[model samples]
Target: MSKNVDYMVAIPARYASTRLAGKPLADVGGAPMIVRVCQKALESSASEVVACVDHELVAQALEPLSRQDSRLTVCMTSQNPRSGTERIAEMLRIRNIDPQTIVVNVQGDEPLITRDHIDEVAALLASSGAQMSTLCNPISSIDDVFDPNCVKVVMDKDNFALYFSRTPIPYERDNFAQGQQAVTELKFKHYHHIGIYGYRAATILDYLQKEPAAIEVAESLEQLRLLHYGMKIAVATTERPPETGVDTAADLERVNRIFASQGK
Candidate 1:
């Protein structure tokens, strides 16, 4: 990957989450979760890092960090963006960022997200010249393959995504018939899709304008919309899996324990 490729890290932080209310403001270590997420983004090779938030309190929470780092900024976005990608699209327009600029969408709740993975996705998009890029990790457990919460992705030989679904793809029919344990003894590797994404500002805008695909609506996966429009999404495998993101109270507790152990 070229060292000179300029990219921006944009995080979408919405205050109201059904599972974990005020998720962005949740305390992790000594700082708010959103602030911790911003710190991670700042550690990346991106030229700029902006947290796109829905609530004023979320922006206020990021004030100290944004003031300390020139590269960090906060943008208050619409409260009702259908998804994080849409919020980022709104932010791009609000900030008047150059359409050609590359932007990486990092979830605000993932405080443990590493700079290496962030940079990897951005570098893949920059070097591959694909419409978008993302990372995935090999599924080591059989439970994750059947778990609807864990989205699965199948890639072509070129490492471009062929399909993404909640249910397993390229189903090992013979192995599955032997039951769950047999499925684990796979002939090919199954992959869990990481949510992070890299795309040009213009690509995001164009994506928003396209009609949502039926498969996207059915599976509740936004990336499918891009595929419906014939966009290429390059995928890379990551050896190091990211720490869990805070989604529920239990997840928050788990992440906090991890932070405490790290002496954060």
Candidate 2:
């Protein structure tokens, strides 16, 4: 972690998940998943860690933890924000955070998220001078290349994102045209976009004001909206892949098992 960099981590802990209701309050080991995620943020070098929650139950779950750590707090936000980005934007506004302050948007479900990745993204945004910053990892499996669930990103020479999609990008025309199922060699690398983000408070507010872009709507990716409005998003590759985030019952079970094995 860069010692000079200072930032806040805002986690959007929406209670109403379609796949798993009250996901933020779901248990991982002996603790609520959002609580675990918040603990991770609190452990980081961030000057402050706030969990932006929509429900009273979610805020209540965090209260005990917040009471133990002064740096950790909870913000009650409206359920109207459609995405985590919007939720964080509202958090910034309600807190009256400085517009130029760097904020990292860490997902509430990512209990096992590493502090290194969190700090890396924030440091990148600070050093690169981009409006936003994110991380990605190389796609090792051919299945991930074709899997729509695995969002792909293509970057320029300087690592600025050119596009993000649910489909394979920088398309391998020859390989696909030849009906090759296996990747014998690579012409270009395929990268899976990591969901973590770092942005200035002002940039997030500016993003909320802009109309959604057609490509963003088509791809179901909010980051494209920033690109459409001519904002630069710095992209960096992390050597260590992030841990699994809880989205479904099976994911919750898996994470629980991992926590149990660790004697957490």
Candidate 3:
């Protein structure tokens, strides 16, 4: 709703995938997954959609489409960055993007990244004056609460994140025994950490300046580093369900099936 909010969407698609090699080019329904992500960003309110990739193959794949859409670009970056945020930072530098530029990070693997959340995050950052903003969804399944890969987050009454972790947060010490009811009860307080993020290009660059915190390395959650440095992260809760990002073969098949069923 904040049309005055200036923002760009960048997808950091690293070719090195520990689980699925060349994940950016992985097929979803009919086209490459990164292409789907790019298309989604293109549909958003952002002024530009840049695909910051690591390999030539990713650049080559995105180049043809970028030529057709001026809003899209393909920039190859060094593969050695610690995380995708670092990769996006490199893109910002290479593109000479202003430090105050608001850039939304739409993960290359999340073809189904929420457009509403993208706008919400950018608006939240602009309105709340937080260094960064991200979206979270209520945990509906017990499987996800205990799933280490599915990071969880707890936010204060002011809607700023208190912490992010793999373990179930705000753990009810006197909750009901395990069952479908308990899962539903946990949903009342627990939230799934959506991987999508929005921040000023300067904010992320400043973040990289800090040394890795013990908590960050311990939890393997990069956002912890920001919180560890006392950066306030605004969180927007959404009813929209979290999409399964492609990582393994099972994940690929699952996303493909979802897209195929939707007649994409």
Candidate 4:
């Protein structure tokens, strides 16, 4: 494995989430969720870690963490951007980041992101030679497979993503009328899409500039924009499923429990 690559983990921390307002700055243990995400990425062998926040209050909350670690670069992006990808693009443009830089988009809500998952997604992009890369863990249980909240991904034989849907895809005909319990015995395979992504600096810029595709609007999936433009997305299978991301108060409690279990 080549460790010399100049990969930068950019965590896009938006403070305006409707589900949990000021979510990125929400307290987890003592430190904020965004800081936890940045620190997790910093654990990886990436060259740099940055928090691309849209609000000044978020930047203020991140200030102390910036002082603690020189690796934490705080960047202010547009507060009105349509998506996380747009915010990252704006930050790259303002900073005049090198086009050669390999940037990874890490969601701020994911406080428990692991280095192994980061390295796995990054390595997939490097080895597959694809413009963009993301990860998904196979769904073993029926509960997660049927939940609409759990976005499912179907991939080609080569592991390139064919489509992403909120609906339970490859719908087992035998289990359609029966329900999740009966589907488990049908020898079916499903996958849940992970929120992390790895892409080149230039590829992201190009993607943001393009118009939103029809499928993207219907499904509310940003990855569809890449696929709509006919860009091949390589899917790397993660050994471990992702930890809970803090989208609501209940989610925060779940993350806190995970941290307590680890004695953090």
Report the C-alpha lDDT of model 4 over 60-174, residue by residue, as the tens digit: 8878878987888999888777678888888899899988678888888999999877877777788888888899988876777788888999999999999998878768776
lDDT of 1: 0.91
Q: What's the candidate order when arranged by decreasing lDDT?
A: 1, 2, 3, 4
Q: Which has the better TM-score: candidate 2, or candidate 4?
A: 2
CA lDDT of every candidate: 0.91, 0.91, 0.86, 0.85
Which residues of candidate 3, in runs, are more than 4 Å off? 176-188
C-alpha RMSD for every candidate: 1.3, 1.4, 2.2, 1.7
Better of 1 and 4 by lDDT: 1
How many Å off is the CA of 163 in candidate 2? 1.0
Clashes of each: 0, 0, 0, 0
Ranking by TM-score: 1, 2, 4, 3
lDDT (0-100) at residue 85 of candidate 4?
83
**Clashes in model 2: which pairs?**
none
lDDT of candidate 3?
0.86
Indicate which candidate wins on TM-score: 1
**Model 4 TM-score, all chains together:** 0.94
Compute the lDDT of residue 55 as modeled in candidate 4.
83
Give the lDDT of residue 186 in candidate 1.
64
Whose TM-score is higher: candidate 2's or candidate 3's?
Answer: 2
